[model samples]
Target: MAELTLLQAINKALEQQMEKDKSVVVFGEDAGFEGGVFRVTAGLQKKFGEDRVFDTPIAEAAIVGNAIGMAINGLKPVAEIQFSGFMFPGYNQIVTHAARMRNRSRGKYGVPMVVRMPYGGGLRALEHHSESLETLFAHIPGLKLVIPSTPYDAKGLMIAAIQDPDPVIFMEPKRIYRAFKQEVPDQEYKVEIGKARVVKKGEGMTVVAWGAMMRETQKALKRLEKENIDVELIDLRTIAPLDYDTVLESVKKTGRLLVVSEQVKSLGIASELITRANEEAFLYLEAPPMRVTGHDITVPLPKGEHHHMVDEKRIAHTIKKLANYEV
Candidate 1:
């Protein structure tokens, strides 16, 4: 095991998979010669040659459309969209074809592909470079949405997504791409998809988040620690196939649920989690489920993003309020 940053870990996962499977191909805008915008695919082309790892034109639609065809032909294609916001141009291909191929063919074909993109804010990126639209893709059936907050999960989940039999939307939080480092295993391992990881055990309340928001939530929880506010924290690694059982169990024990997400407030993941708690854990609730999320507006430009993004102050304040409730 060696300490590696999230970016390095991702590059390692792609390298290991390409080495193991001949069919695995990596391509996107600057993904080959440039090693991706963040260099997450660095040195891939040098080791695998241009055939296995190559660059693509600046066309999201064609990029995804070609990946769907490759998957159907029995080749695993891991295509990067450069940024999450750029995925809009290829929405038709993803929803109409890549997602529905298996069901549409009655199990005759499967789109075993991974669409990796950097998402969320805190990078001071331009408008289109900082959107967190995971909810849009999660609404479509047959697509698995995953967001990893740590280097360990980043490596394991990427490997798992590549091996899965369906299309996987691997949203890597740009905010935490190199935020910190952790001891990641060199050997191949899988952090099973559709599972929520409980990072801390507590009985006072439950705090749920994923991606970059998980880091901010951790900061808030650390502040609450000084006040003796023992709260459980869960990382919903897979957004689409949500691990509702882990969330419900925690709510049952703590009697309070607080979900945080970078995605704008509306019909998003936070709303879905609130609905789940009401449906399955209402009887055990000490107070109505709470949500600390971005406002229902387009993500503001970097200059004013601080006012819109969920930070440690907002999360901690909300947690304190919920803990003080007398219901």
Candidate 2:
């Protein structure tokens, strides 16, 4: 095992996969020769050769359309969009085709491809660079959405995504790409998709988060430790086809729920979590389920981002409020 940042872990996963499987091809805007905007795909082209790893034009639709064609024809194409917000051009192809290919063919075909993009704020990027529109992809049926906050999960989940028979939307958290490092095994591994990881155990409430928010949530949890607010923390690794079983069990045990996400509050993953808690663990709840999420507006310009970003203070405040609330 070696200490690797989240960015390097992704590169490791891609390199290992490309080496193990001849069907895996990687490409995107500047992803090949330049190694991506964040260099998360750094060094892949050099190792795999241009034939297996290369760059594409600035057309997002063409990128995804090309990926879909490669996938159904038996190639596991790992395509990249510079940023998740810029995936709109390719969004149509993903939702309408990549997502429907399996069901349309009645199991005759499956799009064994992974579409990777860096999403979420804290990077203070432009309008189309930092949006965390996970609910969009998570809403689609055939696609699996994944976000990783650590190097270990980034490597494991990415390998799993590449090996998945169906389409997967692998959203990397730009804020934490190089924010931290961890000792990730220097070997190919897979973190089972649709399974949630229990980060910490507590008796007060269930706190669910993923991606960069996981870092901030952990910080808040530490502060609450002084207050003796025991809280269970869950990392929602896979967004779609959520691991509700783990979450529901936690809610039933803790008697409270708090979902934290970077997307807008309306119909977001937080809403879905609360709804599930209400339906499955209603009687166990000591307090109504709550969430601390981003506002329902465009992630503002860099200057106004602090007002929009969810930090430890905001999370800690909400956790304390929910943990201490008397129903």
Candidate 3:
């Protein structure tokens, strides 16, 4: 085992996967020579050579479109979009082709590819550099959405995504790329997609979050402990095939739920989870499910970003308020 940052773990996963499967190839804007915008692909080109690891033009559509073709022809192409907000240009290819390859062909062919992009806020980046658009992709059918909150899961899930038989959108929260470190196994491992991780267990309430928000929520939970507020914490590793079983089980025990996301409040992951809870565990609720999310507007510039991003203070206040509710 080795202690690695989230970024390092991502690179390690790619390296290991490529080593194990010669069909695995990685490419994107500056992914080869430059090692990607955040260096998550650092040294991959050197290890895998130009054929297995290369770069593409600055076109998101072309990048994904080509990867889809590669996947159909038996190559596992891991494509990276510089940022989540920049992925819109390739939305047509992603939703129309890559996501539909398997079903459209009636199981004759599958797009066994992984589209990796850095997402979410707290990085003080430019307008298009900090978007949390996981919800948009999660809404599309035949596409798996995954987000990891720690180095261990980051490595394991990346390997799993590459091995999956269908298209997957692996959204790496850039904010936590180097925020923390964890001991990750040197050998390859798989963190099954469509499963949520229970980071902490408690009987009072259940707090669900993923990506960067998971770190913030953890800080809030630590502070709430001083007030004797014990809450269950769940890190939703994957969003599309949501792990409703884990969430429902925890909510049944806690009788309350609070979902947190950096994306806008309306029609986001939080809303989807709340709807699931209402459908599956409404009678067990002690209070209406709550969400601590960003505003329903474009992410603000650095000068005003604080007003739009969720933080430890906001999450702690919301949890305390919900914990005191008498409903």
Give the per-residue lDDT of model 1 (tens digit) for 1-327.
999999899999999999999999999999999899899999999999998898999999999999999999989999999998889888889999988998989999999999999998878888888788999889999999999999999999999999999999999998899999999999999989999999999999999999999999999988877888889999999998989999999999999999998888889999999999999999999999999988988889989998889999999999999999887
Clashing pairs in 1: none
lDDT tens digits by residue: candidate 3, 72-141: 9989999999998899878899999988888978999999999999988888888888888898899999
What's the TM-score of every candidate structure?
Answer: 0.99, 0.99, 0.99
Candidates sorted by lDDT, descending order? Answer: 3, 1, 2
What C-alpha lDDT, on a 0 to 100 scale, does residue 304 get in candidate 1?
Answer: 92
lDDT of 2 at 212: 96
Segments in model 3 whose C-alpha atoms lie over 4 Å from true places: none
- Model 3 lDDT-worst window of ten: 221-230
| Per-residue alpha-carbon lDDT of candidate 2 for residues 259-302, written as tens digits (9 for 90 to 100) | 98888778999999999898989999999899998888888899
Candidate 2 vs candidate 3: the lDDT winner is 3
Q: Each model's number of backbone clashes? A: 0, 0, 0
Indicate the worst ten consecutive residues by lDDT in candidate 1.
221-230
Over the full model, what C-alpha lDDT does candidate 2 score relative to the true structure?
0.92
